[model samples]
Target: MKINFALSAFLGIALFASCEKKDDPAAANRTELISEKQWILTAVTVDPALPLNGTLVTNWYAQMDECDKDDIAIFRKNGVYEFNEGASKCDPNAPQTAQTTWSFNSTETVVTVGSSSFTLVELTKDKIIDTRVHTINGINYTFTETWGIKPS
Candidate 1:
């Protein structure tokens, strides 16, 4: 009788342990969706076909940050975003300054902004990397950039 009881107890403990809930590892590190987060540009990698190096690249890239200490862009958790150059404040007239909503894909690695979407190839403490395949000026290209999150 004692042997049977011990076996039953062991089985019960094992069954209960097997059914215990476990946390998802990926979900724990996920960044919560929020509003008003500022994303600053760090580096940009353009398609080989695009002019992103040499004199053309330097000239256009300089124009991008002409007004500010650096080229910075802010994507608000509330759906507003600003890409400011050296300008003291974001100018609504600037081509890159616009308000838009964002959504994450099931994996939470890809973000959809307005009607366009980009894959989050990687994200780190100081940089958020993304890639978008698009056609600009009738040429298809993949645009990738690394951006830093601004301090609050």
Candidate 2:
């Protein structure tokens, strides 16, 4: 009889413990989503590929050197942004990491890192996309950059 009573109490307690509110990923805010993962630049595309030295430059990210390609970024909740030179460094003498302050605009639609700001197009757990329109050589171009969670 005592064994059955103890088992029932254990099961009841287990059930209660399982019922505790857990953080829902879908319900997480932008700050939470941004800081949750180490980001790696996946792609950088420019609309209306610019002609450069007889070749149209569309994917700027692909043009980056292997050393530059492996760099990563981490956004901290405390308004700190870290730019990490992953396993490789473009310049051996350069610091392995750089940090700067970051913040979102009043509406959270724009994210400012250092002196630059980008409009957030998409922000998800696995990926983030930001865009900006810049005038280069008197031509307005839309640049889109994408970042994905660093792969294991």
Candidate 3:
């Protein structure tokens, strides 16, 4: 009788331990949202508009040429980033696409493209918000860049 009880207990524990866990993506991991997507630079704004060339600049994206404003940025799973010119090129002599490398820090709070790093203020299925803070001459300015498929 004691042997039967021991065998039953061992089998129960073994069966519970052998249960497989579901392949659920973690909430904190945002890899799925950023990889394999064609994101467009929708807008860029600087708080406390910083002085640039004697002018207080707020909308940074407006400073870009129309050709550059229509470019597409694709972040791939293989760490390669492709900047493709949709239908216009700033320079007719320049290539239609450019390639660069991109990586995220271990914490995934910041993403580095080539040598430049930007803090990720927000990232979702629909959009990505990047920010950079600078203290120039004791003045704090926050530059925010929003990228998405549509107006953000």
Model 1 bad stretches (over 4 Å) = 1-28, 33-36, 51-63, 68-86, 89-98
Best by lDDT: 2
lDDT of 1 by residue, 1-152 (tens): 01121111111100001111225444323343223445555555556445543332322223343233244554555544444443443344545443445556665666665555667766544456666554656766655655666655
**Measured by C-alpha RMSD in angstroms, how accurate is candidate 3?**
20.7
Model 3 segments beyond 4 Å from truth?
A: 1-28, 52-54, 133-141, 150-152
lDDT of each: 0.43, 0.64, 0.61
Candidate 2 Cα outliers beyond 4 Å, as residue runs = 1-26
lDDT of 3 by residue, 14-115 (tens): 000101122443443465677777777777677898687789888866766677667777777887877677677767886777777777776676777766
Steric overlap count per candidate: 9, 0, 0
lDDT winner between 2 and 3, please give it.
Answer: 2
* Pairs that clash in candidate 1: 34-77, 35-77, 35-78, 36-76, 36-77, 67-86, 67-87, 68-85, 68-86
* Candidate 2 local lDDT, 1-152, one digit each (tens): 01121111111100001111235544557677788467877777778886656888877666656776677787888988777778987678868877777788776677777776777777777777777665668877666777788899
Cα distance off (Å), candidate 3, residue 17: 36
Candidate 3 lDDT at 13 equals 8
**How does each model score on TM-score?**
0.55, 0.79, 0.72
State the lDDT at 102 in candidate 1. 54
